[model samples]
Every structure is written in structure tokens, then in C-alpha cells.
Target chain A: MSRLTSVAGSTRAIRATHKTLSSPWATAGAIVIAALWTLPTFGLFLSSFRPAEDITTSGWWTFFAHPRVTLDNYAATLTATSGITVPQALINSLTITIPGALIPITVALLAAYALAWIDFPGRHLLFVAIFAMQIVPLQMLLVPLLRLYTGGLTVGGVAIFPGFAANSMSDGFAQVWLTHTMSALPLAIFMLHNSLSAIPTEIMEAARIDGAGHGRILRSIALPLAMPTVASYAIFQFLWVWNDLLVSTIFTTGKNAPVTKILADLAGMYGQQWHLLTAGTFLAIIVPLIVFFALQRFFVRGLLAGSTKG
Target chain B: MQAFFSWLASLPNIVQVPLVIAAFLVVVAVIIVLIEVAPRPGTAYTWVRAAIAIGFPVIALAVFGLEAGAAWVFGLGAVLGGGLFWLDARSTKGRGRLIQLALFVSPALLLLIVGLVYPTIKTIVAAFMDKTGNQFIGLDNFVWVFSAGGNGGLISLINTVVWVVVAPVAATGVGLIYALWVDRSRAEKLLKVLVFMPMSISLVGGSIIWKFFYDYRQGNQIGLLNQIVAWFGGEPVNWLQHYPLNMFLLIVILVWSQTGFAMVILSAAIKGVPVELVEAAQIDGASSARRFRHIIIPSIRPTIIVVWVTISITSLKVYDVIAVITAGQNSTSVLGYEMVRQFSLMPPQSGHSAALALLIFILVIPFIAYNARTLKRGN
Candidate 1:
């Protein structure tokens, strides 16, 4: 009887505190805002399935009243023609993304280890130089890179950079991967170095006293401890590479083009073709959306890392 | 050495590819042998180490091939990683630390030089050079960019200025209000996720979704916006067909995509505010609004700046949104979109395009510097 009375008293206190936060006005305001944010995507996702004529004649909201769905739009978009097929573009995206994600993370890890632990000459200057490189907009590099690929950069008719990739389309996959990896290096190094530097100096000292070399110390200690930071970056880089359109569009061609490029082209060419556009847009996002949800926590941390101060 | 590499590079790619790989492998083998035999960083071998470090890239570039640039980056990582294992076999107290730093840092440095630093200088030079780039044109490109007609660079500049002003404030405003609303609520996670879903969606996907919402028709409106207008007994409007208005609409798409980013960061900032301070204010008879203004805003000011500069930088280089929706048509163009368009033309306007690229870079510098300074203080 006494225990029950105490529980009731605590419940009353909890309600009293909670009531201050659960105001009717604030809850209703949040609901309205969330609805506004979500409804646009919700409406279009509904539109993607409606019959072509119905989508053009009626708002997607009306579909809630009179239901309809179909897969024809997806089938047509997926079916290969002279242009890109979904299968091929997915392959291209993987081809670009795998190398794009792996190369940078692997390279950044080592560079980060150097920057974080090893006391060396010019470390401060070098780290600053790399970090400063992040501000250079990639658009600045596209024209010269394209020239270097197509015409072999020349100065006074002397071949300064002999165009190495003889076939434009053949080398597009490699070009896309290399450029993404390059652009990612500065931030990757910075973030991963932050994670590496966070390890306790005493732990490192203990490892050194035990005769652990830099490589063993990194492999055993830093890598294991910094796994979360690594996973955060890996997911971030994977999604960026997968969703990337600009680098892929500029550097790649034919079969090498990512899905976003084809969809963007379809959008321009068939602007009024709602049937194709809605289906194609969803198709392009499904992979990323899945990846985003599966790794939501890591993705959030990764996205917010540099946006907030340490 | 140049002639030797040029001759080696001229061989059939099949032969050249294998030769390059074999040669790289042999060098690795030799480096390992040298490290084991001569494990000291303080000897005459220091010059030999430095020479090899410098010589590797030159040989890789001159003899290996450009296709191998990706492989070179990949192999460089492997070599350094492997070197770390080899270097670890030595004693701990030696200045072998310097050698390890050089080994690890050099590959990434080489890539930065090739990828970012060189291209930046090239683009700047291209800005001053003529369309053919045979002679210096001396501000012709800049004049073209600031001129009022064609894919009017002045128009893009104005639109960009508008975007920079509007997108960040609007996004931050919406974000701040939403952050305050859901600050410690039970539904905070769900509500925040609902808004932030758009951040994960590609800018193109968001544009397409919004495009449907803005989809125009002369008949019974299909788009939600037009439907709302029509239900109110008004004419269905082409939202993106109008100038200045279309630019704002583009800004709306950016805000929609970015507001969640702002909200997430700001909400975290708000959560960091001490509960004792807020309670103290309340006990001292501060209203909700005043409590927020005096306590919360001042606490998260750095975060607000960070979010502002980030979105501003994004707005200045805004491309994918404009590309997906209007393709920079009908006064919705930005500098980035125009740069892409100019570069892709038959007679590619490399000069003017490079100039536009440089303009975006110049705009980004101040924001980045400000961010770096503030971050330094924050840390």
C-alpha cells in the first residue's frame, strides 16, 4: 500500500513536469511544419504510380480518394534502348563508387596517421595546405581536366600534358573515380585525423613502450578505436559518390554515365512527360534512400561533422 | 631522363602496363631490402631516400601513363601502408619518425598537387587567356561575364546574390523555429527525421518532386500548388515561367533541401544550452521568447554562423537544383550552371567559363576564411 502511494506520487510529479513541455500549441505547430516538409515528397511519390493521363489531369492528393497504381512506367524506364538502362547505370555507379570510396579512405587513413601522431618536419604547414585546398570549387578544374583528357594540354604547341586516355568513353569510369577521390582527400584527412588524434596519448605511449611499431600501433590501436569515424566517413563518401551527377556527367560518357545524368537528361528532354519523370526520379533515389536509412546515425554524424565546431 | 621515360612511355600499352607494374614492385622490394639492411635515418642514405621519394612520381607520371594515375594513387597507398609495417620493425626512439611521416604524407601530397593545386592555377591562367588560349586576352572574359546579354553573366551574378541573401536566412529561420519547437519533445526524433529526409534525397530528386508539385496545366490543375490556386477559384499559374520569381522558387527548393541540415545542427546547439540557466531565467520571470533570445541565441551563435556560411557557399555554387528543374532557363541560371553550359558548347567558351568559375571561387574564399577563424575560436 505504501509502495503504490509512492509510485502514484512520482507519476504525478512526472506529469507535472511533462505538462509544461507538451503544450497543445507547440505540438500542433510541429505537426503542421512536419506536414509541410513531408507532403511534397509524399505527393510526388504517389504521383509516380498513377496512370499517365490521371497524373496530368488530377493532383496527386486526389489519389488518396481514388486509388490507382502501376509498374509500366518503371518497366519502360528500366528497359534498355540506345540510351542508358537502369542495369548499366547501376553498374556504372558501382564502378565509380567502389573505387571512389575505397581509394580516398585508404589513403586518408595513412595520411591522417602521419598528421596525427608522427612528429615530423613541416607537419603543420602540410596539414594546413591540405585543409585549405578544400575551398577550391571543383568547377574550376573541369575545363582544364577536360582539355587534358581530350586535346593533351599544349603550351606554344608543345605537349605539356599528352592526353593519355586515347578513347574518351573508355577512360570515363577511371576519370570519375579519380576526381571524386581527389576532391574528397582534404576533408577525409581532416576528419579522420581528428578521430585518430582523439586517442589517448598514454595508450600510444604504452604501445610504444611495448615495442609496437607505427604500423602495428595504427592497425591494432588507431584503426580499432577509430572504426566509428571511419564508418561515418565511408557511408558519407559512398552516398556522395553514388548520388553524384556533376563529376560523372562531365568526365564520363556512353555506358560510363551515372543514373542521375540519364534521369536529368530525360527530365530536360521529356519535361512534360510526367509518367517517365516521376518513375525515373524515384528509381534514382531508391538506393540512396535505403543506404541513408540503414546508416541513419552514421550519416547524421558524418553530415554534421564539419558543419559544427569541434 | 626525360628522353628515357618518353621512349619507355611510347611502347605498346600492354607492354608498358606490365613493365610499369613490375618496375614498381621491384622498387618496393628494393625499398624493403634497404630498410632492413640500413635501418638508420641519420646516414648518407637520407639523400638516397629523398631521391627515391621524389623519383617515384616522376617515373610514374612520365613512363607509367595517365590511366595509371588512379592505379598510382592506389599503389601509393599500398606502398606507404606496407612501408609502415616495415618501418615498425625498427627501434622506437630514433628519428625514423621523420622518415615515416615523409612516406605516409608524400602520396596524398602528390595527388593534391596534381588534382587541385595545378588545375586551380591552370583555370586562372585560362581566365586571362583567349578562347583559343594562344594569346592573353586581358579581361575580355571578365567583361563578358559582367556583360548583360546572352546567357548573361550579370543576370547570373544577380541571381546568385539573391540566392546568397535568401536561401541561408530562410533555411536558418525555418530551421531555428523548428529546432526550438521540437527541442526536447518526445516526438523530436521522428519530426526531425521527417524534415531531414529531403537532405538525403538528391537535389535532382527533390527538384523533380517539387517540379510535380509546381507542374502547370491550363485545365484542372494537377500540381498541388496550382490545385490550391484553382480550388480558390483562380487561374493556374506557371510558377517557374516568371523571372525573379522563378529564381525565388529555385531558392525555395534549396531551402527545402538544406533547412533540415540547419535544423539538425541548431537543435544540437540548443540542446547544449544549460538547463540551469534556462530555469534561472524562468525563476527570474523571463517570458519564453525573452528566455530564448537572451540565452539560447547567444549560446548557439557560432553554430548559426557555421550553418549560414555553409548554405551560402552552397547557394553561390548552386547547380544541380537549377540543372534538374529549369536547366538554368528563363532567368533561373546560376554561375555554376552557366559555366557547365559554356564549357559544353561546340566552340567551348573556356575563357568566359573559366572566368565564371574563378568568380565562384573568389566568393567562396571569404566565407571559408571566416569559418576557419570562427572554428579556431570555437575549439
Candidate 2:
């Protein structure tokens, strides 16, 4: 009887709150804001489908007056003979993004496990250092890191390390993959550490008492429990690397550039090619858009876990 | 082996992608398995570990095909692996913990040291050096940065300040309002997705979308903004060519993309507010506005600060939107793009670039500190 009353009381509270929150003014305000936020992208999406001449001649909103559509823009952009085509750049993006997400997650997971479960000296200090490193702007590291990549490390007229020579496409890929892995480590370790440390101590202690080593416990118990966090972070990193423009532009050259860099170049150089630009931009956006809508729950959860852990 | 690798590389991207990913995963898996099994208490396991540690580097040497750096790789790997094995062998029951910690943490530490830490120090040193990064010419680059002249360093610095100040406040305010207005409303999820969709697309893609919106043609008014102007019988202005207006226009793109982030985070924080407090306030005849002002805002203040600081840091590092829209022309350059431009100039002004970079870092420090403080307080 008490349980039923509690359920009824909770529903009453929810209804009351909803009534108070959903006044006409608020509803109207939300609709306006949502429209404002969405219209530009919607217009762009509409234009991407319209015929090239129509897009060049009229505003996308004018589609109502003269509705026409074609896939020729996508075809043209994907098969353009002049520069790096959209398809090649798309492949490059995939190649860069996959290992870019995987390697960092692997490295960060191991470090997070050690920092969370292992009773080591200076662990707190190390964690704090890595946490602080998150604030180091990528600009600070870019010049020196690039120089190191092309010119190597030298001190007192002695070469401490030989720099990477990007003589081939694979070598270039390796350079980008390593750079992304490095830059992503601090935040990845911090977020994973937060979740790993939150696993209850009783379970860990029980496993330890059962003669399970750290690796066994981590692989069997902690990993399965923390899989959701890992998956969320993976999606976050995947989208980030996929959508990144600056790093790829700096690290890659010519045909090796990712889709974002190519799209940016197209927008810059071929500003008059509206149809091609629109199609290419949409193509670049399609993958992350799918990932965003599909894994949105995990993405938002990861954002919250990373930031609002306090 | 060379023939095999060349064949692998020659495969189409569809096949090469999985092949490379599979190879990477296999290597990582092997390392993990080796680490897991190294602790087994047996002579055979010890012998196996020793052999793998010594043999793996040799295999790497053979696979990579001897080059100038071959000796460096082989020597470094052999020493690192052999040293790690020696430590593992020496450690008995309780002492193995430190070695285990080292084994797990070394990859991340080594990468951070090489990629972030060392580069940071090198950048600081380069800031004090000449354009070629050879001679020490102290503070000249910094002076140039603050100097009032045609270099536009002061202009970029002031623009960065304006961006950092205006963008975050506008985005956070708009996001907070949207979050409040849409709270528990029907179609909440769809409404949220509309506002949040911008966060998924690349900044370059967002820039293209907005660039089309701001596009100016002489006759027909292809752009939406100009179309509205034309409807009102006004001249279609060249929006991006105007000086201060152009900067704000570029900022609009940042706000457009980042408002989604602010909204999502602040929305979550709003949901986290205690319902009982809100209900009690409502029962006390507090108006919705009053309840929001008193109850809701205070509850999510920490989150508000976090979102604000996070966006501020992002604003300070704003590059892609400006790079895509204006290419930093018309005096719209901020520190982020300026650093890149300086570094990529004809002669490559390394000192100025490094100084600009260090300046961005210094600008970011306080926001991070404030964020950490609020996080501690929230906890």
C-alpha cells in the first residue's frame, strides 16, 4: 500500500513540475531557439541536394518555389580530376581515426588502471601532473613537435634521436597516429581513472583475497564493469579525430590529407563551386552524424563523466 | 617480409584498413598477454619472457629493414626490454607491485614525456631564441607581440581577448536559457537534438554551412542573410570583408557550434538539481521565474562555471572557424591562427610563433586553475 502511494505521489510531483515548466511562453521560446539553431545546417543540407545551377542562383529556402534535386554534385566531387577527391580523403580519415582512437584508449586504459588500483609511490603526484597537462594548448606543442618530427632531437651538437622521415604514405600515417595518441593521453587517462576508481573497493578486495592478480582482476572484473565508459570514450575520440582539421593539415601533405582538410581546402579555393562544396561538406559530416545519433546516449554520458565528475 | 609488407600496402583501402587495424590490435594484444603472463611463478615462464624480450627487438629490426636509425631502435628496445625483464625477475611476492606499475604506466609516460613535456620545454626555449631558433635574443618576440604597428600582434591579442570574453558568455547564456525553456517539455529529445546537432559536424563543415549563409553575390542574393536584407530593400553587404563585423561574424560560427556543448552540459546539470527543493519553492508561491532565479541557478552554478571555463579555453584556441571563413584576413586573426601563420611564413618566424604559443598557454592557465577550484568545491 505504501509502495503504491509512493508511486502515485511521485507521478503527481512529476505532473505538477511539468505543468509549471511547460508554459506557452517557454514552449514558444524553445521552438524559436531550436529553429534558430537548426536552420543554417538544414538550409545547407537542402542545398546539397539541389541542382548546382539552382543552388548557385537562389537561396535554399526558395526550394519551395522550384524544387529540383540531383546526385551529380556528389558524383562530381567524388570523381573530380583536378585535386584530392572526396573518396580518397574519406579513406584517409578512416585510417587516421581508427588507430587514433584505439592506440590512445589502450595506452590510457593501462595507465588509468595503474593509477587507480595500484598502490604506488608518487601516484597522486603523477595523476595531478597528467591532469594539469590537459591545459597545455596544442599550439604550444605543435611547432616543436613538428620540428622534432622533421628535424629530430639534438642537444650540444649531438643527435639524441633521429626524426621520422615521412617518405611514404604509411610513414605519414604513422606520424599522425602517434601525434594523436600523444595529445589524447592526458584527458583519456583522467576520464578513465575517474570511472575505474569509482568501482567499489569490496569487489577488488574480494578478488584479491581469491588469489587474483591485478591483471586478472582488471581483465575479468574491472574491464567488464568499465566497458560502457570505454565505449563512450571511444566514440568521443572517434568523432574528434574524424572531424579534426588542424592536426591533419599540419601532419599530412597533398593526397594524404583527411576529409576535413580537403573540405576546408575546397571551400577556400573553389568558393564558387557551391554544389561541390555543399556535397563534400555533407559527405564529411555524414559519418559523425550517424555516430552522433546512434551513440548519443553514450556520448553525452562520456561528456558528463569527463567534466562533471566532481 | 618486405614483399609481404609491400603487398599489404598495395591492397585497396577497404582491405588495408582492417588489415592494419588487425595487425595493431594483435601487437597490442600480444604485449598485454605477455605482461599478464610474466608474473607466473615458473622457470619456463621466466625463460619464455627472457627470450621474447630479447627476440622481439631483433624481429622489429628485421621487419623495419636496417636503416640509419636501426641501431638506435635495436639498442634502445633491447636495453628497455632486458632491463624490465631483469627487474621483473628480481621482484618476489610484494615487490612485484612496483614493477607491475612500471610496466603498465611506462608507455603513457614515455609518450607524454616525448610528445608533450619535451616539446613544451623546447617551445619555451624557442620563444627566447631567434627566428631560426639558433641564437638567444631575449624578449624581442614578446616585444613584437605587444608592439603597436603593422605586425598586428596587439590587434590579434585584443581580438583574442574579445573572443574569449564574448563567445563563452553568449553561448552559455543562450544554452542555459534553452535548457530551462525545454526542461521536461514534450518533444524534449527532438528539441535537444536540433540544438545539439551542430556539435557533431566538423568545424570546417559548420564554417561551410555558415559561409553559405553569409555568401554575398552582386545581383540575386544567394545567401540567406542577404536575401533577408534584399527582402527589406537594403543593399546586400559584403559581411566577411568588414572589419569588426567580420570578427563577430566568425565568432557567431564558434557560438553556433559550441552552444550545443554548453546546452548539453548545462542541461544535464539542470536535470541534476534536487526536485524536492524546486517543489518546495513552488509550493511557497514562488513564481516560476523566481524559483528559477533562486533555486535552479544556484544549484547548477558549479556546472555553469565549468561550462563557461571550458568554452573560454576553446575560444582562446579558436582556429578552424576563422581559418575556414576569413583565413585571418581583415584583422580577424587571433593567437591560435597567428601562431600558425607566423610559423608557416616565407622565412618562418619560429620565435614569434613560439612566443604566440606560450602566450596562449599563459592565457589558458587561469581558466584551468579556476575550473579545478570549482571542481574541488563541487566535490
For lDDT, the strongest prediction is: 2
True contact recovery of candidate 1 = 0.50
- Per-residue error for B316 in candidate 1, Å, reads 1.0
lDDT of 2 by residue, B1-379 (tens): 3344446546765676677678867766765665676566667876877766666655654554445544666777788768766775666644345456666787799889988999999999999999999999999999999998838577889999999999999999999999888876787789999999999998999999999999999888789899999999999999999989999989999999989899988886776666788889978999988988999999889989999999999999988987788888899999998898888889999999999999999999999999999889766
Chain B TM-score list for all models? 0.80, 0.89
Over 4 Å off, model 2:
A1-16, A154-160, A166-171, B1-12, B42-95
Encode model 2's per-residue lDDT on A1-310: one tens digit a residue: 2322343456556546766667878878999999888888888899999999999988899899888989998998868633579989998899889989999998899899999998766989999999999998888888877877666565455455445553233434666877899999999999889879989999999998998887788789988888988999999899989989878877876766898988888888878899988899899999999999999989987887777763
Candidate 1's residue-wise lDDT over B1-379, tens digit each? 2333345445643354345445545644443343333334465765555445454444545543333334554456447644544454353656345455555666677678878888899999999988777789999999888877746688887788899999999999999989888764678789999988888888878888888888897777888888888889888889999998888887899999999999988876776665667667878998888987998899889989999999999898888888889988898888888888888778988888889899999999999999999889977
Each candidate's DockQ: 0.38, 0.48
Chain A TM-score for model 1, please?
A: 0.87
Shift in Å, residue A187, candidate 1: 0.9
lDDT of each: 0.76, 0.83
Question: What is the lDDT, from 0 to 100, of the residue A264 in candidate 2?
Answer: 82
Candidate 1: regions farther than 4 A off: A1-19, A80-82, A152-164, A167-171, B1-59, B66-96
Clashing residue pairs in candidate 2 are none
True contacts kept of each: 0.50, 0.58
